[model samples]
Target: MSFGLFQREQRSLFGEILDWMLTPLLLLWPLSLALTWFVAQGIASKPFDRALEFNLQALTQFVVGQNGQVSFNLNAQARDLLRADDSDLVYYQVLDSRSQLISGEPDFPPPRDFETPEPGRVLLRDDLVRGDEVRVAYTWLARPDPERLVLMQVAETKGKRSTLAAEIIKGVMVPQFVILPLAVLLVWLALVRGIRPLNELEQRIRARKPDDLSPIEESAIPQEVAPLVSSINDLLARLTASLTTQRRFLADAAHQLKTPLAGLRMQAELAQRETDPVEIRGSLQQIARSSARATHTVNQLLALARAETTGRTLPSARIDLARLVRGVVQESVPRALEHGIDLGFEGPDHMPDDCLMDGNPILLQEMVRNLVDNAINYSGRGGVVTARVLLDPFSGVQILQVEDNGPGIPENEREFVLQPFYRALGTNVDGSGLGLAIVQEIAQQHGATVLMEDAHTDRSQRGLRAAVRFMPKTPRQE
Candidate 1:
């Protein structure tokens, strides 16, 4: 059976590293044993094979060439030498040129027939002698006749070689069992020490207070982990800025709502104290006006907040800029007529191809409505307010412009008017001062730029023109 190194989901870095390190060591252990066994077998065979060759050469002395015929004659000392081993049986055979067995162990196998009969070369092979496996060493001896030769052979059982090979394998394999476990232990300890710094970083983050938006220290972290720390620091900075903006927005909203709330309280108390019907009606009317002003301020605050928050997350689609603007202008016609100002849309009768853009339609509508409403409020009676959507023929950039012939903002104050709750001086308009701010936020969300400039070149006919330039869509967007 085999086991995989990474058999499950890698949930821990430590486990993963340990598995990679130890799996190879464990898997190669068996392979190492196999290779050691092969080497040991070869080591055990060399001396035994040399001894067999020596005995075969010794037996050659007994083969005599008498009158062109071979005969074997062994002395008592040589016979006792062959039979001396108690652990294993030894055997020998002598064959003359006629393929006749001359003496000793008649069942001993012959040499391979295909071998060219050389004069005095010894060869070794494994064969069965009397049904027992034995190692054989044989040689061809030259006779007087050129084509005839005598064969001498000796063989022995494999008891000593088998014992020596077993000893070698035991010596090589016994220590690995103990060393493998120690190696695994050392690798585990090293990985734990290597990842100690990451654990320390985690503890530091966990100890931080809920309101702590400070950056993490990058210099103390490992070089490999420094990029992760830098990204965390960037996120912390953005979160701090967002929190600060929310605090300031809440403070300003409270301050702006105070005056209308105070007026409502004052008018209610005055109406309660008045006895005359006409005076009571006048107090009630003042109270109604204060409530309306408060309502308008609250609505503007909500719109500005929505533009900042929702515009970032809302999915956008291709919208017809001209048609959207025309619809907003048409909706504001009643308000324009009430103010006695001419509210007219100047653009193509139908939506043009270039006028199509990708934007959140609800946010775009709020932006255009704010522009039109702001113009109607600031432009007094008999003033002309023109809202137009035009496509620049050369650049293909779509533009929405609202021009009003009224008391325009001074060149120095143009940038300041785009900020929330900043109303221009000498304007009697009742506004929450958030219209242009909403316009700016919405324009940023849709990748457009807002510019405030004079409607006419002549300084005497000073009128404000607020233009939103929508950047041309890329090929992918198209």
Candidate 2:
């Protein structure tokens, strides 16, 4: 069968290409053999047919019709020469227009599917004479006006023709019979050699340690496989980043937990020593506070871990930021009241929704809560803290902002605020210092950028504005 370029292709590159090349060669081989046989038969018959025609002309010249009867005078020498073929038996016949044999073989069969030939024109065909396959050539000899015609026919067995055809077929087909298998062997060897590099690459990969998430080398890889290697490298790089984040989180968590647990043990010991109810009560309160701080720090570490891990594997859906932020604000209201800080939600309220973002809602809620909690914790008594979800009309950016009119972080220390366990100098806030770090991690997971700046309508006032701008993923409708 012929191969089409657009047919359903196979995964095996070697097999696909070999099929295209080999199928046509095998299909056409038999046709080539048949054509060669036909050519050989034509070559074998040419001289023999001409010799028969010459003998017929000689026999026709001997015919004397002056007595109104045909006479054949083919001498013994001419008959011996005609029958001299060593490889094939020869026969001849001469007949008059009345269908009576004038001389020669009486048992020679006439041609099947016969048509009368023009006078003096020779014709050749195959026939069975005396139950033997033979080739025949004949001519009709006419003697002018009244059309006195004589038929001279010669027949020869097919042994010589069969032998010559066999020779020609052998000459044309023997080399192909030998070369076809050799060609297949060469093609197979070439395929094996060409695919060896890929096998080597697979072996190299299999030989590597399980922990070896490093990139595969590209310099030695073929151009066709380079893209696959590059993609693997990209995945490795992302995995390295994720692994690094986990390691850092675990280390920071251990360090953060140590201080709070130590304080709790010290406070517990002091409470045991105190006999007075008031002193013991104070020690117990300190122990409770330390335990709470440790718990808070542990929870923050876990949140950061989830942010880093889920970013790559999780599927997100459309989250209503306005609704999520509203819940977070309501939960923080008591804490805001206790701090004597005015914590309020700004932007469009629960009626007509705003700030729709594509993200994991659980992670996003934690992010919003962290930002608001950080603001309230630092915004001393009687300070104003505003939480907002704003959308820019021109840029179509969805922004979540937490601003507080409190003692803000200095310009240089702003960068450190996002680092785990890092607090601004001289801050009297009661916190584990993981809020901003958690906020930064979650913002990264959501494809948003965080910015810290002075939150002041006038330069005279000092505070901080923490804004997270969510870039647009789809075109905004007017």
TM-score leader: 1
Model 2 lDDT, residue 163, Cα: 88
Residue 20 Cα positional deviation in candidate 2, in Å, after optimal superposition: 7.3
Query: How much lDDT does each candidate structure score?
Result: 0.88, 0.82
Instruction: Write the residue-wise lDDT of candidate 2 on 313-396 in tens digits.
Output: 777887877778888999999999998999899976642334466788888889999998888888888999999988776666
Shift in Å, residue 455, candidate 2: 1.9
- lDDT for model 1, please: 0.88
Compute each candidate's TM-score over C-alphas. Answer: 0.85, 0.75
Q: Write the per-residue lDDT of candidate 1 for residues 1-478, one digit (tens) a residue.
A: 1234766553776666677788888889999999999999899999999988888887787778878877787798578658747667799888778878888778889878787778899999999998888899988888656588888888899888888999999998778878888888888898999999999999999999999999998877888789999999999999999999889888888988998999999999999999999999999999999999999999999999999988889988889888899999999999999989999999976656655688999999999999999888888999999999888766668899999998999989999999988999998888888899999999998889999999999998968999999987763233
lDDT of 2: 0.82
TM-score of 1: 0.85
The candidate 2 region of ten consecutive residues with least summed lDDT is 1-10
